[model samples]
Target: MQVNNDRLTLAVAKAPQIYLAGVIDADAPQRFESMMRSGKIANGSDIYLNASGADLHAGIALGRLFRQGSMVTHLGTQRRQRGAPAKPALCTDACVYAYLGGLYRWAPTGADRIGFPAQMAVDPKASADPDDTSAYLKEMDIDQSALAPLLTAAHADPAWLPADQLIAARIANNGRLPLTATYQVQNGEPYLTLAEVKRGGQHRMSLECRRDGVLFTAYNAVGAEHAKQIVAHGARSFVEVNHAESYPPQQDYATVQDDAVVIARTYPGAQLGSLISATTLGAWVRDRNSMLRYGFEFELGGLDHILRKYYQACWEYAPWQVAKKS
Candidate 1:
């Protein structure tokens, strides 16, 4: 266990788990890079962020390093006594920006804290540039709203973000991006696809509206192996909506297509209404012995509006128009 108690201290008492502490000044980045060059810390290491504040530019630089290394950041400090119980740690000012760099970020828990301070007040010689920080946050897929508290904070203190807000805006995402639904056209036919990327892999599903009904297809990259196993032996597949069984299980319903495992089915057009009104959707594969072989769920964010557009493009019909006609 090595410890450095300088302006910024970086230690790797536990392999692949680097512990960081102290204040971050302009030289923080260079010191961090030196720690990196020591080969003690590996890529994708867990970075325990125990620092309080940082120089604006210096924090951004450290953030870029965190992203490049695909690190995970948590708010906590190292224990002087080995195996000691967890203690509270605060990451404030530009340190908040550094925390956002983690590929997989854990929200501040219990007494652990993260906040944004008035940059100039925190460091009189700080080269604080809101534009640069804004761009960096955008690149991290953080909502612009996360920046508002920083720019508008009281000069005497730091603005702390609640854990819920951090998770909602994805500032403390557990290695996942927000799911999105998009309207796309192929061969003059419009369809809707909902997709998301996470540490596990990508999950996508498409809905095609037809005169008879709607065709639903789930493409699961993570389930590719399970799909192949099904083709070789056999298994039952089903779709789930809001944690309830939405489709009947059938043998050999999964098929491998290129890199993903796909399951396609058709349902009554009114089913589209149920889906549009639902909050979550998922697909599953079950073994003959009744075990859950594999599955994944998707949050139906912004899908209702896109599905409405798909209905109009498919059959020149919108639910509101039909409601008005009646």
Candidate 2:
């Protein structure tokens, strides 16, 4: 299911990116979904769009992209003919709705006069379910007042909002997610502050420590103590984080204490069997593998139990069998 008409087209490539141009249509969402499941466009890819808006139901497609956790960026290239004025592309109309789908958005720095149009108000029926729009606004951390003027259905050409307004509404992001964020932990564990936490990773896992609370990470620093608690008994259902690549730049492994589905990940993450020696586990966790093929997946546990044991057997330079947790 592909559409390559002059009005709208979707070009996907191995950079794992999508390029959208022209007007969006109702059926675009279905086609995009097919592309995602078929692995033509992997989930979490970034989107670069050049659209002045959409014909109809484009918001639905944009919302689906947003929920897929794909980042969105407005694309443009301005070249003035000698003595001519500059005309930058505006993500107006339903295009604004789609652009808002980016989890971490970006636009040319200092670029101005970009936003939705008065025509958005042309269809009162489009506002039929303010709840849906309201929900999206909340997720994007955008203000309701911001959308009122931008999405108004008046017949005039709308004045685009400036960067300050967009920044205040958090529509223009520079990659990092606000640590002032909040989320509910389903397992009744206390949520940890995300302050100073890095914001980008595909296979990040969410784990709960007996004393350390919840840690959602895709890197090596979930804390040495957190790793220890993971391999300890009773950690049956923790969430697992992966880098999505078999040989990601950074990695960690571990098994949950039990099996109510601990270490939940979108893909079957790597594991480090308990049968392996703690020394070998330590090398992997410490990233001492001499021939590690970048992007290849291995069976290391969610917390790298071997590293935890290695830390146990050698923490603080204590003697073997006399070290902490040994």
Candidate 3:
């Protein structure tokens, strides 16, 4: 509710933006179902698929293509959602985040190399029927060399190396460059982007970068649009809270660090509620005290109980609506 560009500095103060896309073979659906039932794919795990084997190879090929590129962080396989038994449904969500973060790219063309050893197939009924067969296979052997074209196609023309590799190379090339970029957005508001740079006694690059609003604005816009879409699609969530005083503090408040803002929201039932400081809610409250004040709604028990439970709840139901003048 209180949009504090200042708090964007906290490590966990800001919401993470993600963009995802995937290519899965026909059998991938069945394979994913099997994996879900067998516990091979759990909740919150990052998964990728290629309709054609090409993209699958490209994903794995990243390891070799960016051998010197260490900036790219690889997330491991996460567990599938509790109710969903389909692989595509789960992997799609994961890929969106990876793609938005610029950590992932899928091939425009797919190679239906279903027989590839790296492929994994799920057979939900495999146990019941001994002959039940699934074409899915998990790719274990990643041929980095085979990935060159797929990577190139998935990315913009004159394709850069994989994101992880590119970030690594950028870091290696410029010792002064920051390792990560921070992003933030308020509903119906302009987005903000910030980077952590090394500040020198006489030559502060960070200051220079901030002063160049044009560059920062452009970068922020890119990240902003990407974050917006991700949030709209239910791929990523955001929260606003009071800044914790100590490391891993028990209090539920958002905080800022050098160049990031982190907010946390926990869902009690179906509705997600955020614990925010009064200071943070000042901005939204300044305008109106109505329920529609915040950019989004806190759907705890739906509209029926919104008013009744809102004031009684300890955490603010919708702080974004309470606006305060800077």
Candidate 4:
């Protein structure tokens, strides 16, 4: 059932993606659940929402259902045809609350928008129970301060949140959440550490300067059995730079600790000298016995600049004439 003013609809698209459009009402969550139970919505599907407003309570409920299903949320409407592109969409008012429910929420880009209506426009029931809204935000893992702009906007204007601000405030997690990188001094040596946790798993990669070369350490969370199999059967692991395999002649080995598989490899400075200008870095592991291969690739982008700073810091700390950095 849908409200008279706006008819909410759910449209299943290709595998791992679905479209949810129109206004939300008390029955919206029920409609979504019915589709989910009917196997129309696959696990961890990317749900594109084009909702304008909602019953505040119903939107909160729908958001909870999204989190429970481990879904990814984006801002887009259903395509016009089977293979047509999705139309950009806006999520405003109570609809914004529902978007927050996604485990991995993508920020609205370009013409897409996420906005909060002027105070006078908000539903009376929603404004009356500010506590409910506060509680919903907290439950969604959003900090109260993230909604400060929404709260302080002029009474006559809607508060529009940009893509960058949504990400910076942690209100919207672009793709699979932001990657965090930091520099830390360990054992009197400087190291560049980066980590990101998302739906698939956790990944931690670090770079440190060594006398002979740059040590790259990658620790990824894998199942206990898989980790054992990798260590016992001996897996072939390699590092890729810009889609090209660039490791030294030394074979890479894996160790299992803390339910994670870790590999440490040192690449000569001259070989990795172009790393700062490279486009991507990938860590790959292949089972020696079978065709199973798993890996993760990271785009350099901002990381390249970070690597430059790390190289300079390494030189300042332990100046060596030999080129020995990655």
Candidate 5:
């Protein structure tokens, strides 16, 4: 696996007194109360992971590569353009708001669920022996004729292919055999054709053997490091509480680049604008898995209020020092 761990760091000026209160355990409460009474708390610099931008970029790149030449009827645009094209009219503010607002409304609740815009099970009636094949084709709407060659190449040598590649090939072939007539010969036999076997007992032996062979090769091709990288990259974004600023500038955050994850830091001065900015920053770093892990530093006046209220209140604090580990 290739791991690129470069990272970028951004520094925001934070309120000094609030930052000081965070470091002194014994004096924290008194200092916090004093600041609150004096109304001296002001806007403080906050650190953000900027992972959303990364995710959006990744989505865009992947879309560009995979969805090229595709047309979106509603958008009145093609995924790619050969030359300058007329700009489509903007969607109405109400329509745009409704569409975007719905996405946000459902995002948190739907995070745990796996969603596919198009998913379909194998049509048992369409297959002669569905049990023997058990292959489910997705994206059946895609023109199979355009995808046949890729599938044929992939099926010719499954050993070198990844599961995603295999799935893509299967989808491209419209759920049929992914081979051409040219490469069907193996040991003077037609390897491309499905062979007839006795039903039940004797058939079970051949099926078991074939399954074992597949499992063996699949396991052989998958490396432990590669699997680890995949899991790291796929980890869901987490909100880190209390351990804010523990991250070592860009270096510590960069450690997760291979994993495609990021940590967003929240502090006493956090507001809606800062939060939104941090979230957007975390989302922008794309080399990693396109997820942001948010970190919130706990202190007085930083919690309990709505996002907009919190932002308004936090802007009154003085610049403070961010604690660092010696």
Candidate 6:
């Protein structure tokens, strides 16, 4: 076993396989290309074993290739510190995306599964846009419905999707077929870009999270009608929280680039001259998932083009609560 701290590396065995573990860093693209050229991974001959679960700021383009490198088997702890106990296999952040590279991918249930390993941890700070994953699922020829369950399962800890679910989702198209002699993992769908109108300088947003809950305020000079328009547009576009009546969102402008989150909106109300949105990210709102509140604001009429100023408070998450690690 070879230990290469934190970065992606291959554990060469006495066979024709390369075992990979650790974070896929920014340099992973070049490294992966080198390996593919050097015959470390091949279409029909080599199988890649992955245990990495973090991205370490890796780019999405690099992640695409790393995922397509080979058919991957989620191995738990084949290589570890001396005399250490076996660990649960985890695939978080971009590592999970890379796992999609397989002509055939297999994940063992860590403790409860028969035939395959029992449980694999898949928790990570993930994208908020379901479409981000839905697009990829389309390219992989997998059902888009699989994404919701995967995200929900990976909500707090490592996860294992039932093989039955994968088959039904068509992610396991060939039914646990590990070696596909002539298969090729295709490129995933490109992220979408939509029309955007920035807030210009008319609106100002602020956030403060307390023990009771999080408070968000947006002061807009766009008037009451403007606030209503914002809410109406977001209701049709942004991913609604629970019901449109209870938790209203105003973010529907753009998809975040990475783990970057959008910090906007709340229970926005029109005041004397400004529009304010407030909500509690706690049980006070009777919502357990209310710990983090976010959304976006689109200023009306030429906010971006007329004034030639564009500023939208998108991609906002409480930094103190998150630790991006392996």
Angstrom error at residue 211, model 4: 2.5
Query: What's the C-alpha lDDT at position 229 in model 4?
Result: 72
Better of 2 and 3 by lDDT: 2
> Order of candidates by TM-score, top first?
1, 4, 2, 6, 3, 5
Q: Write the per-residue lDDT of candidate 5 for residues 16-108, one digit (tens) a residue.
A: 211110011233234434544464432221111101111222222212212221211111222135587633322221111111111001111
Q: Of the pair 1 and 4, which is ahead by TM-score?
A: 1
TM-score of each candidate?
0.72, 0.45, 0.18, 0.56, 0.16, 0.36
TM-score of 1: 0.72
Residue-wise C-alpha lDDT for candidate 6, range 223-325, written one tens digit per residue: 4554444433332223222223234445434222222222233432121012112121111111123343234333232232311111111111223332222
Residue range with the least summed lDDT across 10 consecutive positions in model 6: 306-315
* Candidate closer to the true structure by lDDT (higher is better), 1 or 2: 1
Pairing residues by index, what is the TM-score of model 4? 0.56
Put down candidate 4 lDDT per residue, 270-303, tens digits, no spaces.
5445654568777777788888766676766656
After best superposition, candidate 4 residue 282: deviation in angstroms?
A: 1.0
**What do the candidate models score in CA lDDT, each in turn?**
0.70, 0.44, 0.26, 0.71, 0.23, 0.37
Off by over 4 Å in 6: 1-15, 45-63, 66-70, 79-87, 111-133, 153-163, 172-326
Cα lDDT of candidate 4 equals 0.71
CA shift of 27, model 2, Å: 2.0
Once all C-alphas are superposed, what RMSD does model 6 give against the true structure? 21.3
lDDT of 2 by residue, 260-305 (tens): 1123222111122121222211111222333322111223333344
Question: Which tens-of-lDDT digit does each residue in 234-325 have in candidate 3?
Answer: 32222322422212223333232223222332223212122211222111111123233211111112222322243223123234332321
Worst 10 residues of 4 by lDDT: 1-10
Off by over 4 Å in 1: 1-15, 34-43, 77-86, 118-132, 146-156, 159-162, 210-212, 223-235, 248-252, 255-261, 287-293, 303-305, 317-326
